[model samples]
Target: MGGNQTQTQFILLGITDSPRVQMPLFVLFLLIYIVTLVGNVGIITLVRVSPSLHTPMYFFLTHFAFVDICYSTVVSPRMLADLLSEDKTISFADCMMQSQSFTHFAVVECHLLAMMAYDRHVAICHPLLYVTIISSRVCWQLVASSYLFAFLSAIICTWCTFGGSFCGPNRIDHFFCDVVPVLRLMCSDTHSSEMVIFAFVTINVVGTSIIILLSYISIIRTMLRMCSAQKRAKAFHTCASHLTAVALLYGSAFFMYLQPPSSHRSLDKVASILYAVLNPMLNPFIYSLRNKEVKGALVKCRRRFFNHWQQRSVVSSRT
Candidate 1:
Protein backbone atom coordinates (compact mmCIF):
# COMPACT_ATOMS: atom_id res chain seq x y z
CA MET A 1 0.00 0.00 0.00
CA GLY A 2 2.79 2.36 0.84
CA GLY A 3 4.61 1.56 -2.40
CA ASN A 4 1.43 2.04 -4.39
CA GLN A 5 0.74 5.42 -2.77
CA THR A 6 4.29 6.55 -3.34
CA GLN A 7 4.09 5.60 -7.01
CA THR A 8 0.78 7.40 -7.47
CA GLN A 9 2.05 10.56 -5.82
CA PHE A 10 5.22 10.50 -7.85
CA ILE A 11 3.33 10.17 -11.10
CA LEU A 12 1.03 13.06 -10.30
CA LEU A 13 3.84 15.36 -9.25
CA GLY A 14 6.06 14.44 -12.17
CA ILE A 15 3.54 15.28 -14.84
CA THR A 16 3.21 18.85 -16.08
CA ASP A 17 0.95 20.92 -13.86
CA SER A 18 0.72 24.10 -15.88
CA PRO A 19 -2.80 23.72 -17.20
CA ARG A 20 -3.60 27.38 -17.78
CA VAL A 21 -0.68 27.89 -20.11
CA GLN A 22 -1.27 24.73 -22.17
CA MET A 23 -3.39 26.08 -24.99
CA PRO A 24 -1.41 29.29 -25.38
CA LEU A 25 1.89 27.45 -25.31
CA PHE A 26 0.61 24.86 -27.78
CA VAL A 27 -0.52 27.51 -30.28
CA LEU A 28 2.72 29.44 -29.93
CA PHE A 29 4.92 26.39 -30.42
CA LEU A 30 2.80 25.18 -33.34
CA LEU A 31 3.26 28.46 -35.17
CA ILE A 32 6.98 28.45 -34.50
CA TYR A 33 7.31 24.86 -35.72
CA ILE A 34 5.54 25.74 -38.96
CA VAL A 35 7.80 28.72 -39.49
CA THR A 36 10.89 26.66 -38.71
CA LEU A 37 9.94 23.99 -41.22
CA VAL A 38 9.11 26.44 -43.99
CA GLY A 39 12.21 28.58 -43.46
CA ASN A 40 14.69 25.68 -43.25
CA VAL A 41 13.14 23.62 -46.05
CA GLY A 42 13.00 26.72 -48.22
CA ILE A 43 16.69 27.37 -47.63
CA ILE A 44 17.63 23.76 -48.40
CA THR A 45 15.64 23.84 -51.66
CA LEU A 46 17.07 27.21 -52.65
CA VAL A 47 20.66 26.15 -52.03
CA ARG A 48 20.23 22.90 -53.97
CA VAL A 49 18.59 24.46 -57.03
CA SER A 50 20.81 27.53 -57.35
CA PRO A 51 24.02 26.96 -59.29
CA SER A 52 25.58 30.16 -57.98
CA LEU A 53 25.34 28.75 -54.43
CA HIS A 54 27.36 25.62 -55.15
CA THR A 55 30.40 27.08 -53.38
CA PRO A 56 31.72 26.06 -49.95
CA MET A 57 30.08 28.90 -48.02
CA TYR A 58 26.64 27.98 -49.32
CA PHE A 59 27.49 24.35 -48.74
CA PHE A 60 27.91 25.05 -45.03
CA LEU A 61 24.77 27.14 -45.10
CA THR A 62 22.82 24.20 -46.46
CA HIS A 63 24.15 21.99 -43.69
CA PHE A 64 23.17 24.59 -41.15
CA ALA A 65 19.65 24.58 -42.56
CA PHE A 66 19.57 20.81 -42.36
CA VAL A 67 20.79 20.87 -38.76
CA ASP A 68 18.20 23.48 -37.90
CA ILE A 69 15.46 21.30 -39.29
CA CYS A 70 16.73 18.33 -37.32
CA TYR A 71 17.14 20.37 -34.17
CA SER A 72 13.62 21.79 -34.31
CA THR A 73 12.12 18.44 -35.17
CA VAL A 74 13.81 16.81 -32.18
CA VAL A 75 11.96 18.85 -29.62
CA SER A 76 9.12 20.87 -31.07
CA PRO A 77 6.70 18.12 -32.08
CA ARG A 78 6.84 16.38 -28.72
CA MET A 79 6.62 19.72 -26.95
CA LEU A 80 3.56 20.71 -28.94
CA ALA A 81 1.94 17.40 -28.22
CA ASP A 82 2.68 17.60 -24.50
CA LEU A 83 1.06 20.99 -24.32
CA LEU A 84 -2.29 19.71 -25.55
CA SER A 85 -2.23 16.40 -23.68
CA GLU A 86 -3.29 15.89 -20.10
CA ASP A 87 -0.65 13.27 -19.41
CA LYS A 88 2.74 14.57 -20.30
CA THR A 89 4.36 11.22 -19.91
CA ILE A 90 7.25 10.00 -22.00
CA SER A 91 8.54 6.47 -21.79
CA PHE A 92 12.04 6.09 -20.45
CA ALA A 93 13.28 4.82 -23.79
CA ASP A 94 11.56 7.57 -25.74
CA CYS A 95 12.93 10.20 -23.39
CA MET A 96 16.45 8.91 -23.82
CA MET A 97 16.12 8.94 -27.58
CA GLN A 98 14.78 12.48 -27.54
CA SER A 99 17.62 13.54 -25.30
CA GLN A 100 20.17 11.94 -27.59
CA SER A 101 18.78 13.44 -30.78
CA PHE A 102 18.46 16.90 -29.22
CA THR A 103 21.99 16.84 -27.91
CA HIS A 104 23.41 15.61 -31.21
CA PHE A 105 21.86 18.37 -33.26
CA ALA A 106 22.66 20.98 -30.65
CA VAL A 107 26.34 20.04 -30.62
CA VAL A 108 26.44 19.66 -34.40
CA GLU A 109 25.05 23.16 -34.75
CA CYS A 110 27.86 24.52 -32.61
CA HIS A 111 30.51 22.88 -34.76
CA LEU A 112 28.76 23.92 -37.96
CA LEU A 113 28.64 27.52 -36.75
CA ALA A 114 32.30 27.32 -35.80
CA MET A 115 33.11 26.01 -39.27
CA MET A 116 31.21 28.94 -40.76
CA ALA A 117 33.43 31.28 -38.79
CA TYR A 118 36.49 29.45 -40.07
CA ASP A 119 35.19 29.78 -43.63
CA ARG A 120 34.75 33.52 -43.18
CA HIS A 121 38.15 33.70 -41.57
CA VAL A 122 39.78 32.03 -44.54
CA ALA A 123 37.85 34.15 -47.01
CA ILE A 124 38.77 37.37 -45.25
CA CYS A 125 42.30 36.68 -44.00
CA HIS A 126 43.56 34.69 -46.93
CA PRO A 127 41.61 35.89 -49.92
CA LEU A 128 44.39 34.72 -52.25
CA LEU A 129 44.58 31.29 -50.58
CA TYR A 130 40.84 30.88 -49.91
CA VAL A 131 40.32 28.34 -52.65
CA THR A 132 43.38 26.35 -51.69
CA ILE A 133 42.60 26.45 -47.97
CA ILE A 134 38.90 25.49 -47.97
CA SER A 135 38.99 22.93 -50.73
CA SER A 136 36.12 20.51 -51.31
CA ARG A 137 37.99 17.83 -49.42
CA VAL A 138 38.68 20.14 -46.50
CA CYS A 139 35.01 21.22 -46.42
CA TRP A 140 33.82 17.63 -46.30
CA GLN A 141 36.33 16.83 -43.60
CA LEU A 142 35.13 19.71 -41.45
CA VAL A 143 31.50 18.65 -41.93
CA ALA A 144 32.31 15.07 -41.05
CA SER A 145 34.24 16.18 -37.99
CA SER A 146 31.22 18.19 -36.85
CA TYR A 147 28.98 15.16 -37.13
CA LEU A 148 31.47 13.00 -35.26
CA PHE A 149 31.75 15.55 -32.49
CA ALA A 150 27.98 15.78 -32.22
CA PHE A 151 27.61 12.03 -32.07
CA LEU A 152 30.26 11.61 -29.40
CA SER A 153 28.79 14.35 -27.30
CA ALA A 154 25.34 12.82 -27.63
CA ILE A 155 26.65 9.41 -26.64
CA ILE A 156 28.32 10.75 -23.55
CA CYS A 157 25.27 12.75 -22.55
CA THR A 158 22.86 9.91 -23.14
CA TRP A 159 24.98 7.43 -21.26
CA CYS A 160 25.27 9.75 -18.32
CA THR A 161 21.57 10.60 -18.13
CA PHE A 162 20.17 7.20 -18.91
CA GLY A 163 22.50 5.49 -16.51
CA GLY A 164 20.67 7.20 -13.68
CA SER A 165 17.97 5.18 -11.91
CA PHE A 166 14.51 6.64 -12.38
CA CYS A 167 12.61 4.29 -10.08
CA GLY A 168 9.18 5.89 -10.31
CA PRO A 169 8.43 9.42 -11.40
CA ASN A 170 9.41 9.74 -15.03
CA ARG A 171 7.91 13.10 -15.77
CA ILE A 172 10.18 15.68 -17.27
CA ASP A 173 9.32 19.25 -16.69
CA HIS A 174 9.62 21.91 -19.37
CA PHE A 175 8.83 21.00 -22.97
CA PHE A 176 11.41 18.37 -23.92
CA CYS A 177 13.90 15.85 -22.65
CA ASP A 178 16.69 18.13 -21.51
CA VAL A 179 19.54 16.91 -19.35
CA VAL A 180 18.71 18.85 -16.23
CA PRO A 181 15.02 17.95 -16.17
CA VAL A 182 15.81 14.31 -16.64
CA LEU A 183 18.54 14.41 -14.03
CA ARG A 184 16.16 16.01 -11.60
CA LEU A 185 13.91 12.99 -11.82
CA MET A 186 16.69 10.60 -10.92
CA CYS A 187 16.57 8.87 -7.59
CA SER A 188 20.33 8.44 -7.46
CA ASP A 189 23.09 10.90 -6.73
CA THR A 190 23.50 12.93 -9.91
CA HIS A 191 26.21 15.32 -8.81
CA SER A 192 28.90 13.55 -10.77
CA SER A 193 26.68 13.14 -13.79
CA GLU A 194 25.72 16.77 -13.67
CA MET A 195 29.38 17.71 -13.44
CA VAL A 196 30.20 15.60 -16.46
CA ILE A 197 27.35 17.17 -18.38
CA PHE A 198 28.58 20.60 -17.37
CA ALA A 199 32.06 19.71 -18.53
CA PHE A 200 30.85 18.47 -21.93
CA VAL A 201 28.58 21.46 -22.36
CA THR A 202 31.48 23.74 -21.52
CA ILE A 203 33.77 22.01 -23.98
CA ASN A 204 31.20 21.98 -26.76
CA VAL A 205 29.76 25.45 -26.13
CA VAL A 206 32.57 27.51 -24.67
CA GLY A 207 35.35 25.68 -26.40
CA THR A 208 33.81 25.96 -29.85
CA SER A 209 32.81 29.59 -29.27
CA ILE A 210 36.36 30.42 -28.23
CA ILE A 211 37.79 28.85 -31.38
CA ILE A 212 35.29 30.72 -33.53
CA LEU A 213 36.08 33.96 -31.75
CA LEU A 214 39.81 33.50 -32.25
CA SER A 215 39.32 32.78 -35.93
CA TYR A 216 37.17 35.86 -36.40
CA ILE A 217 39.58 37.97 -34.35
CA SER A 218 42.45 36.98 -36.57
CA ILE A 219 40.35 37.65 -39.64
CA ILE A 220 39.38 41.08 -38.36
CA ARG A 221 42.98 42.01 -37.55
CA THR A 222 44.07 40.94 -41.00
CA MET A 223 41.26 42.94 -42.58
CA LEU A 224 42.26 46.02 -40.57
CA ARG A 225 45.80 45.70 -41.85
CA MET A 226 44.57 45.50 -45.44
CA CYS A 227 42.90 48.92 -44.93
CA SER A 228 40.42 48.55 -47.77
CA ALA A 229 37.13 50.00 -46.52
CA GLN A 230 35.07 48.17 -49.12
CA LYS A 231 36.65 44.81 -48.41
CA ARG A 232 36.52 45.30 -44.64
CA ALA A 233 32.86 46.25 -44.81
CA LYS A 234 32.09 43.27 -46.97
CA ALA A 235 33.89 40.91 -44.59
CA PHE A 236 32.09 42.39 -41.63
CA HIS A 237 28.76 41.98 -43.37
CA THR A 238 29.41 38.31 -43.95
CA CYS A 239 30.79 37.75 -40.47
CA ALA A 240 27.84 39.52 -38.86
CA SER A 241 25.32 36.80 -39.70
CA HIS A 242 27.58 34.05 -38.41
CA LEU A 243 28.42 36.05 -35.31
CA THR A 244 24.74 36.59 -34.54
CA ALA A 245 24.16 32.88 -34.77
CA VAL A 246 27.10 32.13 -32.53
CA ALA A 247 25.99 34.61 -29.95
CA LEU A 248 22.48 33.20 -29.83
CA LEU A 249 23.68 29.62 -29.58
CA TYR A 250 26.54 30.02 -27.12
CA GLY A 251 24.83 32.64 -25.03
CA SER A 252 21.81 30.46 -24.37
CA ALA A 253 23.75 27.22 -23.95
CA PHE A 254 26.34 28.65 -21.61
CA PHE A 255 23.74 30.36 -19.50
CA MET A 256 21.68 27.22 -19.21
CA TYR A 257 24.43 24.75 -18.49
CA LEU A 258 26.99 26.87 -16.62
CA GLN A 259 24.71 27.97 -13.82
CA PRO A 260 23.74 25.95 -10.76
CA PRO A 261 20.61 23.98 -11.47
CA SER A 262 18.48 24.99 -8.48
CA SER A 263 18.25 28.67 -9.23
CA HIS A 264 18.14 28.60 -13.01
CA ARG A 265 15.88 25.79 -14.29
CA SER A 266 13.19 28.19 -15.48
CA LEU A 267 15.72 30.43 -17.17
CA ASP A 268 17.30 27.40 -18.78
CA LYS A 269 14.01 26.30 -20.25
CA VAL A 270 13.36 29.75 -21.73
CA ALA A 271 16.88 29.98 -23.12
CA SER A 272 16.68 26.48 -24.57
CA ILE A 273 13.46 27.41 -26.34
CA LEU A 274 15.16 30.42 -27.95
CA TYR A 275 17.93 28.40 -29.57
CA ALA A 276 15.90 25.28 -30.25
CA VAL A 277 12.87 26.99 -31.81
CA LEU A 278 13.69 30.62 -32.47
CA ASN A 279 17.22 30.26 -33.81
CA PRO A 280 16.33 27.58 -36.36
CA MET A 281 13.43 29.69 -37.57
CA LEU A 282 15.59 32.79 -37.79
CA ASN A 283 18.73 31.29 -39.40
CA PRO A 284 17.45 30.94 -42.96
CA PHE A 285 15.88 34.39 -42.90
CA ILE A 286 19.11 35.90 -41.62
CA TYR A 287 21.14 34.24 -44.37
CA SER A 288 18.73 34.82 -47.22
CA LEU A 289 17.83 38.39 -46.32
CA ARG A 290 21.38 39.51 -45.63
CA ASN A 291 23.35 37.49 -48.17
CA LYS A 292 23.34 38.64 -51.75
CA GLU A 293 24.08 35.18 -53.08
CA VAL A 294 21.45 33.50 -50.97
CA LYS A 295 18.90 36.17 -51.77
CA GLY A 296 19.51 35.77 -55.49
CA ALA A 297 19.27 32.03 -55.19
CA LEU A 298 16.06 32.29 -53.21
CA VAL A 299 14.56 34.64 -55.73
CA LYS A 300 15.49 32.39 -58.64
CA CYS A 301 14.12 29.33 -56.86
CA ARG A 302 10.87 31.12 -56.06
CA ARG A 303 10.40 32.15 -59.70
CA ARG A 304 10.98 28.61 -60.86
CA PHE A 305 8.61 27.16 -58.29
CA PHE A 306 5.94 29.67 -59.21
CA ASN A 307 6.38 28.98 -62.91
CA HIS A 308 6.15 25.25 -62.36
CA TRP A 309 2.96 25.64 -60.35
CA GLN A 310 1.50 27.88 -63.00
CA GLN A 311 2.33 25.37 -65.73
CA ARG A 312 0.69 22.60 -63.73
CA SER A 313 -2.37 24.74 -63.18
CA VAL A 314 -2.60 25.47 -66.88
CA VAL A 315 -2.36 21.76 -67.75
CA SER A 316 -5.07 20.91 -65.21
CA SER A 317 -7.33 23.63 -66.61
CA ARG A 318 -6.86 22.30 -70.17
CA THR A 319 -7.67 18.80 -69.01
Candidate 2:
Protein backbone atom coordinates (compact mmCIF):
# COMPACT_ATOMS: atom_id res chain seq x y z
CA MET A 1 0.00 0.00 0.00
CA GLY A 2 2.88 2.38 0.84
CA GLY A 3 4.67 1.48 -2.43
CA ASN A 4 1.44 1.90 -4.36
CA GLN A 5 0.88 5.31 -2.82
CA THR A 6 4.46 6.35 -3.64
CA GLN A 7 4.08 5.18 -7.23
CA THR A 8 0.81 7.03 -7.61
CA GLN A 9 2.40 10.22 -6.31
CA PHE A 10 5.10 10.35 -8.99
CA ILE A 11 3.87 12.91 -11.50
CA LEU A 12 4.30 12.58 -15.25
CA LEU A 13 3.99 15.69 -17.41
CA GLY A 14 4.35 17.15 -20.98
CA ILE A 15 2.18 17.25 -24.09
CA THR A 16 3.36 13.96 -25.52
CA ASP A 17 2.86 12.16 -22.24
CA SER A 18 -0.81 12.29 -23.20
CA PRO A 19 -2.31 9.82 -25.66
CA ARG A 20 -4.00 12.40 -27.85
CA VAL A 21 -0.98 14.20 -29.32
CA GLN A 22 1.96 11.83 -28.95
CA MET A 23 2.58 10.46 -32.45
CA PRO A 24 1.55 13.54 -34.37
CA LEU A 25 3.61 15.94 -32.28
CA PHE A 26 6.59 13.63 -32.33
CA VAL A 27 6.64 13.49 -36.14
CA LEU A 28 6.23 17.26 -36.41
CA PHE A 29 9.04 18.05 -33.99
CA LEU A 30 11.32 15.43 -35.54
CA LEU A 31 11.14 17.23 -38.87
CA ILE A 32 11.68 20.64 -37.29
CA TYR A 33 14.61 19.38 -35.26
CA ILE A 34 16.31 17.97 -38.35
CA VAL A 35 15.84 21.16 -40.37
CA THR A 36 17.18 23.22 -37.51
CA LEU A 37 20.37 21.19 -37.27
CA VAL A 38 20.98 21.21 -41.01
CA GLY A 39 20.35 24.91 -41.41
CA ASN A 40 22.52 26.05 -38.48
CA VAL A 41 25.31 23.65 -39.32
CA GLY A 42 25.29 24.74 -42.96
CA ILE A 43 25.55 28.40 -41.99
CA ILE A 44 28.46 27.74 -39.65
CA THR A 45 30.30 25.70 -42.24
CA LEU A 46 29.72 28.28 -44.96
CA VAL A 47 31.04 31.11 -42.81
CA ARG A 48 34.11 29.20 -41.67
CA VAL A 49 35.34 27.88 -45.04
CA SER A 50 34.86 31.05 -47.08
CA PRO A 51 37.73 33.52 -46.62
CA SER A 52 35.86 36.38 -48.28
CA LEU A 53 33.14 35.98 -45.68
CA HIS A 54 35.47 37.05 -42.88
CA THR A 55 34.17 40.26 -41.32
CA PRO A 56 32.72 41.45 -38.04
CA MET A 57 29.20 40.80 -39.37
CA TYR A 58 29.88 37.19 -40.38
CA PHE A 59 32.04 36.65 -37.31
CA PHE A 60 29.11 37.43 -35.08
CA LEU A 61 26.83 35.52 -37.43
CA THR A 62 28.96 32.40 -37.07
CA HIS A 63 28.62 32.64 -33.33
CA PHE A 64 24.88 33.13 -33.75
CA ALA A 65 24.76 29.94 -35.77
CA PHE A 66 26.63 28.09 -33.07
CA VAL A 67 24.36 29.51 -30.38
CA ASP A 68 21.26 28.51 -32.35
CA ILE A 69 22.56 24.97 -32.61
CA CYS A 70 23.40 24.87 -28.91
CA TYR A 71 20.07 26.38 -27.92
CA SER A 72 18.08 23.82 -29.90
CA THR A 73 20.20 20.95 -28.61
CA VAL A 74 19.63 22.03 -25.03
CA VAL A 75 15.90 21.37 -25.22
CA SER A 76 14.80 19.54 -28.35
CA PRO A 77 16.49 16.16 -28.02
CA ARG A 78 15.21 15.45 -24.56
CA MET A 79 11.80 16.74 -25.49
CA LEU A 80 11.79 14.46 -28.53
CA ALA A 81 12.76 11.50 -26.39
CA ASP A 82 10.04 12.29 -23.94
CA LEU A 83 7.55 12.16 -26.80
CA LEU A 84 8.25 8.48 -27.32
CA SER A 85 8.43 7.47 -23.69
CA GLU A 86 5.46 6.18 -21.65
CA ASP A 87 6.54 8.18 -18.62
CA LYS A 88 7.70 11.74 -19.28
CA THR A 89 9.22 12.20 -15.86
CA ILE A 90 12.45 14.09 -15.25
CA SER A 91 14.42 13.64 -12.04
CA PHE A 92 14.83 16.72 -9.85
CA ALA A 93 18.56 17.04 -10.56
CA ASP A 94 18.02 16.55 -14.30
CA CYS A 95 15.33 19.17 -14.29
CA MET A 96 17.58 21.67 -12.54
CA MET A 97 20.44 21.07 -14.96
CA GLN A 98 18.12 21.47 -17.95
CA SER A 99 16.77 24.73 -16.58
CA GLN A 100 20.28 26.07 -15.96
CA SER A 101 21.65 25.23 -19.41
CA PHE A 102 18.48 26.31 -21.20
CA THR A 103 18.44 29.64 -19.39
CA HIS A 104 22.13 30.18 -20.08
CA PHE A 105 21.79 29.62 -23.81
CA ALA A 106 18.56 31.61 -24.10
CA VAL A 107 19.94 34.64 -22.20
CA VAL A 108 23.18 34.63 -24.16
CA GLU A 109 21.22 34.54 -27.42
CA CYS A 110 19.20 37.59 -26.37
CA HIS A 111 22.32 39.71 -25.79
CA LEU A 112 24.09 38.23 -28.78
CA LEU A 113 21.24 39.31 -31.06
CA ALA A 114 21.51 42.81 -29.59
CA MET A 115 25.25 42.80 -30.15
CA MET A 116 24.65 41.74 -33.74
CA ALA A 117 22.35 44.71 -34.15
CA TYR A 118 25.04 46.98 -32.80
CA ASP A 119 27.42 45.45 -35.31
CA ARG A 120 25.02 46.23 -38.12
CA HIS A 121 24.57 49.78 -36.85
CA VAL A 122 28.28 50.45 -36.96
CA ALA A 123 28.70 48.80 -40.33
CA ILE A 124 25.90 50.80 -41.90
CA CYS A 125 26.05 54.18 -40.16
CA HIS A 126 29.80 54.52 -39.74
CA PRO A 127 31.25 52.79 -42.77
CA LEU A 128 34.47 54.78 -42.46
CA LEU A 129 34.79 53.93 -38.78
CA TYR A 130 33.42 50.37 -38.98
CA VAL A 131 36.88 48.80 -38.93
CA THR A 132 38.09 50.79 -35.95
CA ILE A 133 34.82 50.59 -34.04
CA ILE A 134 34.42 46.84 -34.46
CA SER A 135 37.99 45.82 -34.06
CA SER A 136 38.88 42.23 -33.13
CA ARG A 137 39.49 43.15 -29.51
CA VAL A 138 36.17 44.96 -29.25
CA CYS A 139 34.35 42.05 -30.93
CA TRP A 140 35.95 39.53 -28.60
CA GLN A 141 35.02 41.66 -25.60
CA LEU A 142 31.42 41.86 -26.74
CA VAL A 143 31.15 38.11 -27.22
CA ALA A 144 32.89 37.43 -23.92
CA SER A 145 30.64 39.85 -22.04
CA SER A 146 27.50 38.32 -23.58
CA TYR A 147 28.54 34.86 -22.40
CA LEU A 148 29.60 36.13 -18.96
CA PHE A 149 26.29 37.87 -18.30
CA ALA A 150 24.30 34.88 -19.53
CA PHE A 151 26.21 32.51 -17.29
CA LEU A 152 25.74 34.80 -14.30
CA SER A 153 22.00 35.12 -14.91
CA ALA A 154 21.58 31.37 -15.38
CA ILE A 155 23.51 30.62 -12.18
CA ILE A 156 21.47 33.08 -10.10
CA CYS A 157 18.16 31.82 -11.45
CA THR A 158 19.17 28.19 -11.00
CA TRP A 159 20.16 28.83 -7.40
CA CYS A 160 16.87 30.54 -6.68
CA THR A 161 14.71 27.82 -8.25
CA PHE A 162 16.63 24.64 -7.42
CA GLY A 163 17.32 25.35 -3.73
CA GLY A 164 13.63 25.35 -2.97
CA SER A 165 11.45 22.32 -2.16
CA PHE A 166 9.62 19.93 -4.43
CA CYS A 167 7.62 17.99 -1.91
CA GLY A 168 5.54 15.91 -4.31
CA PRO A 169 4.12 15.48 -7.83
CA ASN A 170 7.21 16.82 -9.65
CA ARG A 171 5.83 17.15 -13.14
CA ILE A 172 6.88 19.94 -15.55
CA ASP A 173 4.16 20.45 -18.16
CA HIS A 174 6.29 21.92 -20.90
CA PHE A 175 8.87 20.25 -23.10
CA PHE A 176 11.91 21.56 -21.20
CA CYS A 177 12.54 22.64 -17.63
CA ASP A 178 11.70 26.31 -17.99
CA VAL A 179 11.36 28.56 -14.96
CA VAL A 180 7.58 28.86 -14.92
CA PRO A 181 6.91 25.17 -15.45
CA VAL A 182 9.45 24.09 -12.87
CA LEU A 183 8.25 26.69 -10.37
CA ARG A 184 4.74 25.33 -10.74
CA LEU A 185 6.00 21.96 -9.55
CA MET A 186 7.64 23.29 -6.39
CA CYS A 187 5.82 22.99 -3.08
CA SER A 188 7.53 25.93 -1.40
CA ASP A 189 6.31 29.50 -1.61
CA THR A 190 7.90 30.83 -4.81
CA HIS A 191 7.06 34.51 -4.71
CA SER A 192 10.67 35.60 -4.36
CA SER A 193 11.91 33.08 -6.88
CA GLU A 194 9.26 34.10 -9.39
CA MET A 195 10.22 37.73 -8.95
CA VAL A 196 13.85 36.96 -9.64
CA ILE A 197 12.96 34.99 -12.73
CA PHE A 198 10.71 37.79 -13.91
CA ALA A 199 13.45 40.35 -13.39
CA PHE A 200 16.01 38.34 -15.35
CA VAL A 201 13.58 37.62 -18.18
CA THR A 202 12.70 41.31 -18.33
CA ILE A 203 16.33 42.31 -18.60
CA ASN A 204 17.03 39.86 -21.38
CA VAL A 205 13.84 40.44 -23.32
CA VAL A 206 12.75 44.00 -22.49
CA GLY A 207 16.13 45.54 -21.81
CA THR A 208 17.88 44.19 -24.86
CA SER A 209 14.76 44.79 -26.92
CA ILE A 210 14.78 48.51 -26.01
CA ILE A 211 18.42 48.75 -26.97
CA ILE A 212 17.75 47.03 -30.29
CA LEU A 213 14.85 49.36 -31.02
CA LEU A 214 16.98 52.42 -30.25
CA SER A 215 19.85 51.21 -32.41
CA TYR A 216 17.58 50.51 -35.35
CA ILE A 217 15.93 53.88 -34.94
CA SER A 218 19.31 55.54 -35.14
CA ILE A 219 20.24 53.38 -38.08
CA ILE A 220 17.09 54.24 -40.01
CA ARG A 221 17.53 57.93 -39.28
CA THR A 222 21.11 57.81 -40.47
CA MET A 223 20.15 55.88 -43.60
CA LEU A 224 17.57 58.51 -44.52
CA ARG A 225 20.27 61.16 -44.44
CA MET A 226 22.66 59.28 -46.74
CA CYS A 227 23.27 60.80 -50.18
CA SER A 228 23.73 57.55 -52.07
CA ALA A 229 20.56 55.61 -52.87
CA GLN A 230 22.60 52.45 -53.43
CA LYS A 231 24.24 52.66 -50.04
CA ARG A 232 20.97 53.37 -48.27
CA ALA A 233 19.27 50.42 -49.95
CA LYS A 234 22.15 48.13 -49.00
CA ALA A 235 22.02 49.32 -45.41
CA PHE A 236 18.28 48.74 -45.18
CA HIS A 237 18.63 45.27 -46.60
CA THR A 238 21.35 44.35 -44.14
CA CYS A 239 19.44 45.71 -41.18
CA ALA A 240 16.21 43.97 -42.16
CA SER A 241 17.55 40.47 -41.44
CA HIS A 242 18.74 41.36 -37.96
CA LEU A 243 15.52 43.21 -37.29
CA THR A 244 13.39 40.22 -38.23
CA ALA A 245 15.40 37.89 -35.98
CA VAL A 246 15.18 40.30 -33.04
CA ALA A 247 11.47 40.81 -33.51
CA LEU A 248 10.66 37.10 -33.53
CA LEU A 249 12.83 36.27 -30.53
CA TYR A 250 11.72 39.12 -28.25
CA GLY A 251 8.12 39.02 -29.38
CA SER A 252 7.63 35.40 -28.37
CA ALA A 253 9.70 35.71 -25.20
CA PHE A 254 7.82 38.78 -23.97
CA PHE A 255 4.48 37.19 -24.73
CA MET A 256 5.49 34.22 -22.62
CA TYR A 257 6.84 36.04 -19.57
CA LEU A 258 5.10 39.42 -19.36
CA GLN A 259 1.68 37.93 -18.77
CA PRO A 260 0.14 37.05 -15.40
CA PRO A 261 0.69 33.54 -14.07
CA SER A 262 -2.87 32.50 -14.88
CA SER A 263 -2.13 32.85 -18.61
CA HIS A 264 1.49 31.60 -18.52
CA ARG A 265 1.16 27.83 -18.45
CA SER A 266 -1.27 27.67 -21.36
CA LEU A 267 1.02 29.74 -23.58
CA ASP A 268 4.30 28.45 -22.21
CA LYS A 269 4.63 25.46 -24.52
CA VAL A 270 3.93 27.51 -27.65
CA ALA A 271 6.29 30.34 -26.66
CA SER A 272 9.06 27.89 -25.84
CA ILE A 273 8.75 26.43 -29.34
CA LEU A 274 9.44 29.79 -31.01
CA TYR A 275 12.77 30.76 -29.48
CA ALA A 276 13.91 27.23 -28.70
CA VAL A 277 13.16 25.56 -32.03
CA LEU A 278 11.87 27.85 -34.77
CA ASN A 279 14.13 30.84 -34.15
CA PRO A 280 17.29 28.78 -34.56
CA MET A 281 15.98 27.23 -37.74
CA LEU A 282 15.14 30.65 -39.12
CA ASN A 283 18.45 32.29 -38.20
CA PRO A 284 20.42 30.58 -40.94
CA PHE A 285 17.87 31.28 -43.64
CA ILE A 286 17.60 34.92 -42.54
CA TYR A 287 21.32 35.46 -42.79
CA SER A 288 21.75 33.55 -46.00
CA LEU A 289 18.74 34.84 -47.87
CA ARG A 290 18.98 38.50 -46.80
CA ASN A 291 22.68 39.20 -46.74
CA LYS A 292 24.35 39.24 -50.14
CA GLU A 293 27.68 38.34 -48.61
CA VAL A 294 26.34 35.24 -46.87
CA LYS A 295 24.52 34.13 -49.99
CA GLY A 296 27.67 34.56 -52.04
CA ALA A 297 29.68 32.60 -49.49
CA LEU A 298 27.14 29.81 -49.50
CA VAL A 299 27.29 29.65 -53.27
CA LYS A 300 31.05 29.50 -53.16
CA CYS A 301 31.04 26.84 -50.48
CA ARG A 302 28.61 24.66 -52.42
CA ARG A 303 30.66 24.95 -55.58
CA ARG A 304 33.83 24.07 -53.71
CA PHE A 305 32.23 21.12 -51.98
CA PHE A 306 30.99 19.71 -55.26
CA ASN A 307 34.27 20.44 -57.05
CA HIS A 308 36.23 18.59 -54.38
CA TRP A 309 33.86 15.65 -54.66
CA GLN A 310 34.11 15.55 -58.47
CA GLN A 311 37.91 15.72 -58.32
CA ARG A 312 38.04 12.77 -55.97
CA SER A 313 35.75 10.83 -58.31
CA VAL A 314 37.94 11.62 -61.31
CA VAL A 315 41.12 10.56 -59.50
CA SER A 316 39.55 7.26 -58.47
CA SER A 317 38.37 6.58 -62.02
CA ARG A 318 41.92 7.25 -63.41
CA THR A 319 43.52 5.02 -60.77
TM-score leader: 2
RMSD of 2: 3.8
Tens-place lDDT digits, model 1, residues 7-76: 2212212224678877887788799899999998988887778899888888998899999999899888
Tens-digit lDDT string for candidate 2 (126-231): 8899999999999899999999999999999888777676666656677787777766766778788888888988888888888888889889999989999998
CA lDDT, every model vs. true structure:
0.80, 0.81
True-structure RMSD, every candidate:
4.1, 3.8
**lDDT score of residue 231 within candidate 1:** 78
Off by over 4 Å in 1: 1-20, 303-319
Which ranges of candidate 2 are over 4 A from the true structure? 1-12, 17-20, 310-319
